[model samples]
Target: MRHQDERPEAPWAATNRPPMGWNSWDSYGTTVTEAEVLANARFLAGHDEGVLAAAGWDTVVVDIQWYEPTARPGGYNDDAPVLFDDHGFLQPVPARFPSSAGGRGFAPLASAVHDLGLRFGLHLMRGIARRAVEADLPVPGTPYRTGEIADTSSTCPWNSDCYGLRHDHPGAQAWLDAMVDHVVGWGVDFLKVDDMLAPYHRDAVEALSLAVRRAEQRHGRRVVVSLSPGTELSLAHLEHLREHADLWRVSDDLWDRWPDVEAQLGRMARWAPHSGPAGWADADMLPLGRIGVRAERGEPRHSLLTTDERRALLSLWCLARSPLFVGGDLPTSDAATVADLAHPGLLEVAHRSGGGRELLREGPTGAETAVWGAATPDGATRWVGVFSTAAEARRVRVPAAAAGLPGAPDVVVDVWSGERVPLASAGPATGGDTVLDVEVPAHGVRLLRLGTRAHSGTPGPEEHTWQG
Candidate 1:
């Protein structure tokens, strides 16, 4: 294990905030087509003044199985031949992505997305394609053959499409370099590398990171690398993670159920301390609006969570400062769903705030409530999130002192409602001992922005409300 101070400096220093985007996985899964991807990209890149574009949701990521010719919902053909170039580099399946037919690859689609003023990304599994190894193809810019670099003994536990590369093999780094160069030419802005971090493939991650850095230097492009499906990672590996990728998952796939959302409270808390400007602990994609429309996990349907649950989910993710990857079919999303994603207050907390930390978590079994807090960019205001995990409505309270906001706050704005919530004394306390009490609906949240007396003025009638 490397000490915090002994770790190498991070390769990519341009990621100032967590990424905000829409992914094709939760909604379209392995069977997502080029037409579907373009539709979502159009939805995200709506008129320059559209809600999504205005909220800085400018990335459109095409998830896994894009190279498979016969991919479908809930099924993967492990025996299907993997597609690759003569140099052992993977390419899009022309049958599925027609634009890539004349060996143009994703360049045409990437240009289309770029024309819409949106960034394009792709999902990739770690290691070399199994078929490439079997074919004994040459690795571009390297003297060794693909078979020489392949580590036949190591493979993904769940997917058989690829074989792990041997870190000791002389051609491993060259192979990665070739792969990165290919994507760089295609204008990929982000690369969500899966099956690497979850199983702690340190050598592969390091090789890939270095390859990305080298490719960026060679092509003069910045491609954000994100690790996915991080089921479990030790605190000792925090330095390594930050040194390699821009974003790494903190939990496994988080679905649309309340339980999945509730489980993230603890995961986020545990990983919060490790999150910073260089790297973030992803809580997985947001499963809201219409989802699983041909997904591998379940049948197509609208999100199962209630409106309040959706709000809580966004509140928690924003307060935790996790990367926001909207996972629904954007084109089919309702107006209300779009409004939720476009909320300025939530976006502020997610992209501009800092020093986020868990404050309180307490309640009886099956009815717990949790509190998370973060400092606004200017540090004059505090963004707080109070979540009710119960099935029944609950009154959640937090003393100003507990929230690190000393003295009486002149105004407390409910982020979602844009209404001012009145503060009252918790008990026999006086002055600065005031506590805020608000009724949070079951599976709901109260996202508040605290304005201190010194920095705030009296609120108008329309802005003031007492829910206690």
Candidate 2:
């Protein structure tokens, strides 16, 4: 079915840009504490003209295992007692988050983040907690026990903390509704639900969507519903995802590696048609700066990706309009990393452009160079990206027609360097179309802003040139 036929209107019209934020997974893993979260929040909202603040990064997300009292850096104790209320709704571990004591939940932390001019978010698993089911806790507003609504046969493949909900049971919806109510009360602005999308669990996704909608109606709050670990979903499921989630992961946990980054080019192309103001195709978190400080996957160190590779990653993500979640330890990041994250041109394309599309993909089967284009929000200019996916440096040419520019653009500025690149030919071409040629290093990218003519009284090409 068509997107419009599946949904009457954009369910998440409130969200216009892809959500940008700092998530705790790559930096602190499952052991991130309240102090660490606050430190990052402080840096994000710091008055020192930080990169995060300058780049409009406004969300602070606490990733998985926040409720597990015995959670450690590299592992999780699934059998350990989790912090939850009598109604089976999870809460932060007070030992790690003292503010959540006295049955206050995350309201205190969320309020602090709000005070800093940012939104707060949390990570959650798919269904009822195993502990709640074992205890047979009563479903809120209903007499049915947790076991009645829990689907014992359905469990997350990677985590042992929860069982999927039985959609056939009325109590399942009630349980989900109560969970949303509690989180909404905690002032959550976003929720990343994991283990629900990778396998394309339609029943659970629909149930959670209904529960979130009901909670929004009841409390008048907007929470961006994000589904996680999108490694297996197909194009056939696009409508279902758009109808349910504000953002959904388009790839697995993307890390700091060239192959993983290279693989996303095609994934983004396939998912691009489904992305828009209402729903985004998330190209997971950017693992730059100080990652794996306390991670499960690898030892603590700076990202292995070269500076050029990092730029390519960011450029492609912007061209695709994917959600930007920085997975670095912000307080410890170096000055260069911060400056890279604050590139104004890339941020503008990411947040202010529309109609992103891949214009070209050519070369051998595995060693292709790709070009992508998107128009500025006002349609006055076009942003173009040329990426080299080969093992060696390659020269790429993007024709003006392919880039969606009217005629041959009189002005073309490198987005990163701000240097005006002289067109190969001055006026319209006689025999062939005008093309912009760029030499991109292996796994590197070149971004350009094209316009028919320079803005009136705008600085001359040399004036805006970046020395670096």
Sequence-dependent TM-score of model 2: 0.91
Q: Cα lDDT of model 1 overall?
A: 0.80
User: What's the TM-score of every candidate structure?
Assistant: 0.92, 0.91
Clash list (residue pairs), candidate 1: none
Assess candidate 1 and give its TM-score to the true structure. Answer: 0.92
Q: Which parts of model 2 have CA positions greater than 4 angstroms off?
A: 1-16, 78-80, 426-431, 452-468
Candidate 1, residues 92-185, lDDT tens digits: the string is 8887788998788999999999999888999998998898999998888778899999998988877788899988987988888888889878
Q: Write the residue-wise lDDT of candidate 2 on 1-468 in tens digits.
A: 123333323323443457888999999888888988888898888836665764668889999988988887777666667777888888899888999999999999999999988889999999988898988888878989997989989988878888899999999989998898889789988899999877889988888888877777677767788998898668788778877888899888988999999999999988875787757899899999899998867889889898889999998888898988898898898767767777776776776567888888888855788888987555667788888888788777667776677677768888878888765553454247777878888889888888764432222444321111
How well does candidate 1 score on lDDT at residue 205? 85
Candidate 1 lowest-lDDT run of ten:
459-468
